[model samples]
Target: MTRVLLLGGTGDALAIARALPTTHVYSLAGLGRVPGDLACTVRVGGFGGIDGLVRYLRDEHITLVVDATHPYAAQMSRHAFDACALADVPLWAVRRPAWQPQAGDDWREASDWREIVECIAPFHRPLFTLGREALAHLHDIPASQHWTIRCLDAHPGNARASIVDARGPFDLAGERALFDAARIDVVVSKNSGGRATEAKLAVARERGIAVVMLTRPALPDADRIFDDAASARDALQHWLTRP
Candidate 1:
């Protein structure tokens, strides 16, 4: 009788989603492409908020919640934690560790946008891999700086910036070419721990350019937590199948 509700968006979430049974639900925020291949029922859009989520849990008879959302999605993770508590359902999460600075990494931690802007003020050409969030501040780009933003989709950036619509799992050689061609002196990125987009960090490290990394936000505690997707998926399947 146990039914799972997976709150997902990132690749890690998708991997976990693939392991779910047909009866379980995989939910998305309607930003990226919905996978046509998932066996589990895909639920697009939000559940309103904490109250709405609680109602959904009760109505759908969801006994457990898996928070496989992005590391930066602190709000949604909090909502899942609260909603599960209200509905008296178990809440589990996949907490991926953040990427740490290596030997040659010239990394600078930024708690917020203000700090990020200040840290990169000395650079003329900066590459941003922080998604569309940076697009909002197009007008705020400093007079001396030019931004090269790489996101999932293309956008017509203003005079101060240009958008590169591309996906990740970027290779070191390619990233090196990008840095060299753009004359990039700095990189602005979220410390989203994964191999997919980590090439930029290596590229920055070798060039000795500074990387202004956004620190991970503190998330609410879960009933159970897994470090990676494979473990979470295995645990869910075993829990569901075990007598």
Candidate 2:
């Protein structure tokens, strides 16, 4: 069986791993915390850097590499590209299509994270899905303004707004409930487009809430990027079959 190294953590990566065909898969998870029932053998933490990754590929005799890491994780993507080149191993990047605003959607596009903070000031009740790190930026925005922040982890010191500590793959019903409970009128989120957090968009569409969407950061020069798991699996199979 071909040995495959998968750079993962995001839901897209998990999907890819589940779709792989009979390969001996080794998954690299960046977060110290591992998900329940991960389908393959897993390795947590960084591979030091490019040099380290190159050595690992050679030592383990990995035939191919699939980078299905988060879009925000640009550094790992760059390292994967570089290390694969050095090791002469095939590499692929699996990226989901970004969410675009629909007709009648009240969407304001922010160029960066800082711009997202400024854009939310005009709204009375803002629902923030930009993750926990972004809460500090909104500190001066005002506590009485009513903000709802959702994140994977709990924010202990956050006093300005209501925090929802939850993991995602969230559905429309849950999103609607949260928005209704918070009395949210505005939604702010990064364009970190994937099915994992797409319920926010769905809720916003149904409620006609304004969305302050941040654009995606650029990706590295990956071998190829596919929008779905089936296409990614096909690419992986082609790579494995190639002499």
**How does each model score on lDDT?**
0.92, 0.78
Query: What TM-score, to 2 decimals, does candidate 1 have?
Result: 0.97
lDDT of 2: 0.78
| Steric overlap count per candidate | 1, 0
Could you give me the TM-score of model 2 versus the true structure? 0.86
lDDT of 1 by residue, 1-243 (tens): 989999999888999998887999999988878999999999999999999999999999999999999999999999999999999999999999889999999999999989988999888999998888899999898899899999988799988898999877799999999998889999999999988899999888888999999989999999999989989999988999989
In the range 1-243, model 2's lDDT, one tens digit per residue, is 478898887777777677554445646655435755655667777788999999999988897788888777778898899999999998888877788888768899888766876788788888888776566754675755777788777775355677788888899888888888889999988787777788888888877889998787788777777886678877776766878
Candidate 2 residues lying further than 4 Å off, grouped into runs, are 19-29, 135-141, 234-243
Q: Using Cα atoms with residue i matched to residue i, what is each candidate's TM-score against the true structure?
A: 0.97, 0.86
